[model samples]
Target: MKKNYFILLFILIITSQACGVSVKYSFTGTNLDPRVKSVQIDYFPNNAVLVEPSLSQTFTTNFRDLFLTQANLDLVDSGGDLQFEGEITGYKINPMTATAEQTAAQNRLTITVNVRFYNNIVEDDNFERNFSHYYDYDADTQLIGSALDDAFEEIIERISQDIFNASVAKW
Candidate 1:
């Protein structure tokens, strides 16, 4: 019985291979089309009322890096199979938790990015959407230096992942 089971499994594997049955998976959860060979990431400008000096550059580079590391696609200046362009629409800080003394115990910083994606290989995959995320910090910690950097990193990471999912991930 044991030998029969092994033989049956072997036969199944061989039959599947012969029939060209296969599955592809990506660790990054991207299900990009095979025709997508390259990506073009346009500059992400900060158009928010409260702009961070390094936000534009940081976001653009990080967004491109995600494609660079995860996708087997070239980064092109133009005429890419996939394209992305967007602007920072909102950057606002609001008080979160208030202390007993009527002071802000915590504050939240939220950043919103408006994204437009183009898929040359599949026009139906194109989309435009807004991605937003927030980071909370102690009210005593000013939004400068490392505090600001941490906030940027957290928010950017979430937005980048959301954009990635929207563009290529089917789930």
Candidate 2:
């Protein structure tokens, strides 16, 4: 019995070592490479028709925070291995018509962010892409303002995840 237990323990240790864990992801033809050591993310400017007073700052700060938490790269003001900059290119809210009553019953808010990224360490790896997401709330809700604020939070979360996946996760 003791011999069997020792064998099981040894096998478990070997199998765990063979699992091939890695912090960096690998993609065959993706622009993301693991050579990057640092990143610079400039403040995202807002160019949308409907301006939320703090939307730009919120977006920029959120993006930075997301990267800091998700990726292993360090943040730098200049001379970084990677760099990104862009703007909030679009924001819109439109009424959604309810099919049951043939009337508007809710509003859909959509926000779009366009980012341009360059990998200075890897000359061939560069990306420019636009990522957008939307959220909706009932028209009858008295706290429409708060609902919109929540929508923006969700949108930013998605955008941050998308950017991180594109830049590091190789998706």
Query: Per-residue alpha-carbon lDDT of model 1 for 131-158, expressed as tens digits?
Result: 9999999999989999899999999999
Instruction: Summarize candidate 2's per-residue lDDT along 50-119 as a digit string, tens digits.
Output: 8887889989999999878766679999888889899999898788768577776987888899999887
User: For model 2, how many clashes?
Assistant: 0
Residue 39, model 1, lDDT: 93
Off-target runs (Cα >4 Å) in candidate 1 are 1-24
Worst 10 residues of 2 by lDDT: 21-30
- What TM-score, computed on C-alpha atoms, does each candidate reach? 0.87, 0.76
lDDT assessment of candidate 2: 0.80
Q: In model 2, what lDDT does residue 166 have?
A: 80
